[model samples]
Target: MSQNLAEPVAHDGCLLSDLAAALGVASDTADVRVTSVTSATDMAVPGSLFVALPGARTHGAAHAAAAAERGAVAALTDEAGAERTRAAGLPTVVHPAPREVLGRAAAFVYGTEPGDPRLIAVTGTNGKTTTTYLLHALFEALGVRDGLSGTVERRVGEHAVETRLSGRLTTPEADYLHGLVARMREERVEAASLEVSAQAITHHRVDGLLFDVAVFTNLTQDHLDDYGTLDNYFAAKLPLFTPERSRRGVTLIDDEWGRRLAAEAAVPMTTVSTDPGADADWHLATREVGLDRTEFDLTARDGRSLSSAVNQPGWFVALDTALSIVALTEIGYDLDRIDAALAGRGGLEARLPGRLDPVNPGGEGPRIYVDYGHTPASFRTVLTTLRGFTKGRLFMVFGADGDRDATKRPDMARSAALADVVVVTDYNPRFEDPAAIRATLVRTLEDEFPGLEHYEIPDSAEGIDKAVSLAEEGDIIFVGGHGHRQDVEVRGRLIPYSVKDAARAALAKHGWSTR
Candidate 1:
């Protein structure tokens, strides 16, 4: 919670003339010094500027007293919030849209301008973590030390800073985002990569920053609860690729959506794919997929083919590898640099968790994988992929998150029906009734495949234990939903539990050898 030394507070504020120009505030009489910047009233430090924004339930101006008491020197607000902020003897920065300008205001205070660094943004429903890490690896190979922000971790060069960030809600608010980037600048990071969430674009979390290159992995049917429609969700994400200033784009044409996106992109565009007939700028032909390593032939637009090996397990990793190649090439790196870096590039730890991973010792009956596949598309994709490798029955243990897009619950059930045995369970019920969610999923699965063996075990831990008991030799048990999440939000509080850890515990209890 301490103020960063690299971004010391400007108690006297930045030069009033400079601030006005940067903020596009044309008024000459508005001269003020800002000590700090904050969005939450409770965290408002003395001499800090409080950003009062309209929230889902209440306006931030309603907490003006708390902010003022905590040392807020001034407040930025719209007309409705101006009177409240002004009454507290706090200087007011009145504007029609204060929330939209907070990131720029914070960047102005922090002395970091747009496009000052090589900012690369990767957006998609999946593969963001792998793509971000892949870009980080490419940067390392080229001696380009960089900062990275994603679901798994945030790092500035080799130093992994613990981030209070998680899940598909990838991008943080602009204030924290710019501040993090400013810290990366202070850390002497030449480049930085971050996952731009669809919500981030909708909420303007990345408004002030311009990406040097934007990557689109693909889009699918997810986050319908927020956007109301898949088209609206995709539209929210399209702007990142079509930035007015920064237009260099690298898209993975593995999916139909990626193919469609490439056609509409205005920036210097490069297409990458693992599929044949890509006609893409970068193509990867999968040569082999062993348990421990995957080899591929990467051919660039210039007709140079680079034979590479990625030390990762998924059959679908080719899609990720192709995107990584395109990302590196767009950043002005050559094939030799890409090959040398990836030669030593290790697997992204903890991303695939127990399922795709074979870290367990031999004679463990069947391998169980714990993943975060909830949507029908992701569920089907994971199940179908696992089905390809399973010589025996495939037992699936999964359930939809509560109060989310309930529309996908039936589709998830249908996908699970494809498995030899389906064990449905809970995953972060939030406030919605867990039993209701389970019943809905179970009923749908039963209706779709009446003859399919299915069980309803609401407690996820119990379901894991049961799955391990039912696994036979060559059977692959997939414990999907809640991958890398340390806790499940039940009601309003977080219960410490992880699907991967729980799966491991189940294996140990069932007399399986875990190295």
Candidate 2:
């Protein structure tokens, strides 16, 4: 997506000398101007500066020629890549640590080293997307213009919003993130919220920019294949709370991880919680639990009692939305008007997607929901919640990712066993046998509860069909893993797939008509 700006004020390109200065190096012989910075060979355009780094098995310098042919002006890389790009006939800017400095170089090229738009960053294993989107909708309700970057979609703002990016990394690479901010400035966006993944923090994707407010959503077991342990994963999320990364912090102290972060945060911090036992900036007490909503009251640290409700059921929903509320209040939103804004925004469901979201395909049928709960803890919270509400029976359809933390596969299966019925199916078996993954899930289900009745459906789409066929009018069927994802990775390739679409198609095949 491109923006239209007045021609009277021209956008001056970045000089290579400025980049050299930022890198603390002297380079007068290769002085030149570049319009953009990139890490991939295919994205090189005229006036682009290619950044080549060392990958796990191969160096990015391997594609130097391809970048040169695409009109890339020069290259920035480590010493190893310098030799390769120099041989490809392009002058190189060598740095000992390229990835760490990549963001500064990109900001120099994009001219967004520090730009407009108040930035808010949310991070955790779960609820990052939901919290960001909740803030986005609240801003909209208050007649404030904003932007969003998260797992479901990336929306760059104008009077008419343009979803410039989607279905990619929760946080983009260093160069791309700075480029995105440049675009946001072009669109006249005044505020924004971004979901920061732990992988992004570990990779230095958000290193150069300082956030206005940083949020913690609570950590759980995830990404162990890359981190190997919970402590390492928590360490990866620590940088975002340091003085260099954010101006202030709004932490949710609902779990032990969150409590520990609030206790040790390096930046100024405020904490929120849904736990009745928690002592924080906000403490929640449940008032009512209904099929459509759960009402709660919060006691602020300053002795003000505020009333709120998670417009959806589940202890997790209340926990996340409570943090969203406290975060906005800390960001200087008027406390008295907070309840009015949420009421005008049509509640949480209208703002966020894929978190305990019910998908109604037809009339007088079983209640069906599609959620992004994949971790063992998430599965237990979701499956058990639905089980309590089902009048007839509870059916759960879910699976785990291949080539990921296989240690959690049995844990996921055990959680799903909480339902009256369970279907073990493929989620994303990238480069792994789908049937073998299904066998592991089913075997775990059998071991956990001997003679437990469950179905082994290797294909997710077909598995959804099987789950729907078994549903009665009063039953609740829940599908997990690929919540808002439009595709699934099979043999390392993303194939077009949708759990919501599959559920609707299954209902249609069963002669269920839309009301």
Best by TM-score: 2
> Across residues 386-461, which tens digit of lDDT does each residue of candidate 2 receive?
7778899899999888888887888888888888889888888988787888888998988878877799888888
Model 1 agreement with the true structure over 1-515: per-residue lDDT tens digits? 22332243322446434554676764235456765667766556656777889877888888887888988877777888878887886777776788888877877766666555678898988777767776776676667888888766677777866443333357777766766777777677888888888888888888778788888877877889999887788788878777653558888787778877788766777888776676888877888775566777878778877777666655566667667666666777777766765665543222333335442536567877666556676677677877877889999888888768887788889878878999999988999999999999888977778888989998898998898888876888887777767888888788899776777788888888655
Each prediction's Cα RMSD? 3.2, 3.0
> What are the clashing pairs of model 1?
13-33, 13-34, 46-71, 355-369
Off by over 4 Å in 2: 1-10, 87-89, 113-115, 158-167, 289-291, 309-311, 343-349
Scored by lDDT, model 1 comes in at 0.74
Please, what is the TM-score per model? Answer: 0.90, 0.92
**What does the lDDT come to for candidate 2?**
0.79
Candidate 1 accuracy as TM-score: 0.90
